[model samples]
Target: MAVSSSLSSIHISPRTPKTPRAERLEDGEEDVELELLGEDERYRATQDLDGTDGQAMEAATSKQPISAKDKRSMVLLCVLYLIQGVPLGLALGSVPFLLKEHLSYSQLATFALSSYPYSLKLLWSPIVDSVFFKSVGRRKSWIVPMQFIVGTLMLYISLNVQKLLDDPGNNVGELTFIFTLLVSLSATQDIAVDGWALTLLSQDCLSYASTCQTIGLNTGFFASFTVFLAFNSEAFAAKWGVPHLTLSAYLRFWSIVCYAVTLWLLFFKKEDKEPATEADMSIKGVYKTIWTICKLKHVQLLIVMHLFAKVGFAANDAATSLKMVEKGFKREDLAIAVLIDFPFQIIGGWLAARWSRGDRPLRPWIYAFWPRLGFGLVATLIVYWFPKPPISMGFFAFLVFHTVLSSFASTVQFVGISAFHTRVSDPLIGGTYMTLLNTFTNMGGTWPKWFILKGVDLFSVATCKVSDAGVDIAVKAAECVSDHGKALCKDINGTCVTETDGYYVVSALCMVFGVIFLVAYIIPTARKLQALPTSAWRVKMS
Candidate 1:
């Protein structure tokens, strides 16, 4: 059967008669009519060869009916993705602020190097596909061991966090090593889980995979980022009987959770293994499959789009948290902003799925692009006007508006793009191909941060002066102007003093790329691409 993404494209029927333009104006529904291509015509568009008529019909016969087993499969996949999210949440959301008290902005970015392992995971995906223990299961063999190591590492960190906190300078190297190791293990486990999903879910149920990922990931992020931080706060800790909540305690809690989940997976879950083909059983075959995917014309275009799609707002996202902190936004304030953003994100995903269902699977991308660009500019302004005085009710109103608008637009765009990738990736190499798309997306968001950090280092300045009594205090460059005009304070009073301009420039770059891709590539090509049936991506393994 044709392996289509659950969030598949709209099948426009060619038989619909053309109508006047007036039909589109009724109730905001689109009225344009076009010839709907048959599934065979769509499938042929993605094929490189002729004469597979009998095989194509045979392929269509593989569709299976849903039963209780299918429902259990979906639930297991959701749990697997959720488990993948916890450590990821801890790494990206919590680690920055947790280390903020000691690390400078530059140091924080430097240490955040650990998080980039996820972006590079495609490099080792072939190995993940090629090797496994026969006793447990191919995917489970990797998943269980990786999770065990990850849990052990978290517990190890919990035990020694006090020594590290006491002497951050001496212990930072160790902390970075441990954190990087933790992130690496979590990323590897992701490979196993993703591969398992491909094997477990039926084609009809595959589209919901991205939805499951978004929900589970966001939930885990809220828990690790917001809830854990709250638990570690002085107010909560004291109220809960601990006067001082050490990092060890916070980590230990998660360590126990990880261990419990590991046990659950080992005993409670059963993997019904499928026999591996010759290519799947060998490393050479894995690379050959990867090579074949890269050579596909549509897949090649997708790689480029995935790389540049998010470039417009990358720096803004990376700098927002630190910029907020510099503007006196507390940890709780950042957490609250994310809390407001989360549900809107999930709603956006649901909306995208609904909108993509019938005649225009790519419609969300077109509709969401303009808002994303507008809000990208709006977010830049919010960052530009950092540390505004009095922190008024109106200020928070703007914050809420910005967060909600941006989150909605971004989530919609993400859902469309993720579904598009899934729709086009060959199922034989599903895990590896999907990882490649995600790796590119992650890299698009990452490379810009390096430049943003470099600009911050070059342009922004921070200084502390020590008094005779041995008290040291931070001094804003604007404050030093009266005492040190021209000689030291030139261009230091406002706008030019902070890295806000860097954000503006980056946001503009993203908008330029967005327009280029939308107008030049995405809009013109979307209709033709969507016309191709989901079967266009399927191939017999070599």
Candidate 2:
């Protein structure tokens, strides 16, 4: 069977001839009209027709049943994306809480360096897109090895993580280096999987690809974060009458899981072969395509939008949970909040995916932006009002409620944007194209984090004090800011005292920036971009 035929069996009914324009407008209820096209023709068709145009040309494409191949593809995508999320969840979600106990905001900020690899993966995405062992499989060649490496790294980290965290000197630099490598490997795997997803599913159902991504990634994140924290927390274990799980043991288990998953994929899963007339796979060609994509006005606008869009939420996202922890909210309790939010996030993603369909895929994203930002402000208040220990059930319930709302908005924005990306991305260079957009999106959130964390320390007013009999002598502010300085203060029997908390200051400023960004740039630019034809997002290859 021809590739298109094997992918989906279209059933177009006989109808009276009509003008192309009339056919497009009047045939709204007809079965999807899928045409057989050679690789070159398909590429040209993609460039000429935006996602909306493509859907219009297909009429009511939703009537078509998903092929078995597409079903298999969806399963493959979910598994691959789930595996990809494990390390990220551990790095961004769980590790920060663990570090917050012993590390200063500055030290935690330094640890944020590990996440940069994910944001910077676009730098090498072209290589991943272009170079692969075609015989082994375009994507699998990269996915298999990268995942194997990831599993190995996890095993290594499992062995050393506890000792590294326990060291009085605190191995922030070393941990950053190690996790950076892990995240980089995962990012590379992500590029491969993203590319594969485009080819795996038929064009009509492309949007669900992002849905699978959201569900799978969030599930992995929940497992590594909420479940891990709950299991590892002594308080949680004691309260629940369950065995306490060690971080090392948890990491080792996932490492083994990673290895098992990797082996399954390598042996059991088979990648589809690319057609001979596919786009150029050369490094130069892929880079050239990236350059062309960058030159597009729409892509440039989206990049700028992605870079500035997350500034408003940076403080809430990066610091709120840690701040709550600083203020005596237990990690286990925080985990409970996340657990409540988890199901809602998945539900939000599903709803967003449904809402993100049609021409204006960014509609839901645009709608959710302000609400998400508003919740960020609310988060600061929640943290500020966080009660001292022996907290009431009502207060915990409120926290969970706030978390669900905040996460729901965030999830909607994420899924909506991802759906828009899936619609606009050219599948010819799916890896590079998707990676480029995703990189900017990730960078929008990642780049501001380090500064946000550092700002907390910069704005904080604290003093190192030593007791001389009944009197206390205050040391310089500079002497208590650095980890080394704090250690030195501790050596002389001095304790750090906080006069002012910077979380409020930074969060208030971030909310202001968010409002400014939303009004001046995000809303207007997003509206304009969404109104543009999908052709604007496609690179016109010569």
Best by lDDT: 2
Model 2: ten consecutive residues of lowest lDDT: 1-10
Give the whole-model CA lDDT for all candidates, comma-separated: 0.60, 0.75
lDDT per residue for candidate 2 within 462-497, as digits (tens), equals 788999998999975652544444666788899977
TM, every model: 0.77, 0.87
Pairing residues by index, what is the TM-score of model 2? 0.87
The local lDDT score (0 to 100) that residue 314 gets in candidate 1 is 65
Over 4 Å off in model 2, which ranges? 1-59, 62-68, 465-467, 479-496
lDDT of 1 by residue, 197-313 (tens): 655655544545566666666666666776666666776566667555456776787777777877887887767665444335367777776776666555566667656666666
Cα misplacement distance, residue 531 of candidate 1 (Å): 3.9
The lDDT, on a scale of 0 to 1, for candidate 2 is: 0.75
Q: After superposition, how far is residue 510 of candidate 2 from its true place, in Å?
A: 1.1
